[model samples]
Target: MLELVVHPRVSARHPQLSDEDVRVAWQNSFFQALRTGSKNSPEYLWIGIDGKGREIEMVGVPTATGYLIYHANTPLSKRVRDEVKGRRT
Candidate 1:
């Protein structure tokens, strides 16, 4: 199991999500993409279902130990949901 380091900003920005919610989402990630073209560290976008069965979207960078999640949200846009569902089929 990879270590999970959630940035403080995650909770600050998304008060509805708890640390455990983020962890479950990461562990259950069904769709992930490497996000390039940033001047900073390489980042990744992950979409997964939490234990409560809610879809969660997370953005973060990989760390030597594991992954550092900086952002997380729910109820993805219709376009994104459609795209992800299409990929699964």
Candidate 2:
């Protein structure tokens, strides 16, 4: 099981999402890639569907024990969605 540690800032930034929503998104991730231009620790970007069936974009960094999710939001940009779709094909 992948342990997910959601940062407190996530709620502040996206109050509409709950911990459960974040968990669901992680579990259902369809696209994930290591973010480019990271300075320190490696950061990852993920796109997944939540329990509500809403597409969510998540950003996080891997920790010693698990992933620390620092950001999550819905309605991903068309460019990003298209990029992911292109990669899938």
What TM-score would each prediction reach against the true structure? 0.82, 0.83
At residue 86, what lDDT does model 2 achieve? Answer: 74
**What's the distance in Å from true for residue 53, model 2?**
0.3
lDDT per residue as tens, model 2, 15-87 = 9988889889989998898867667359888999998999988889998788999888877867667867776
Candidate 2, which segments miss by more than 4 Å at Cα? 78-89
- Tell me the spans in candidate 1 whose CA falls farther than 4 Å from its real position: 77-89
lDDT of 1 by residue, 1-89 (tens): 67999888888888888889999989999889776755545978799899999899888888888999988888776766675677678
lDDT of 2: 0.85
RMSD, one per candidate, in order: 2.7, 2.2
Number of clashing residue pairs in every model? Answer: 0, 0
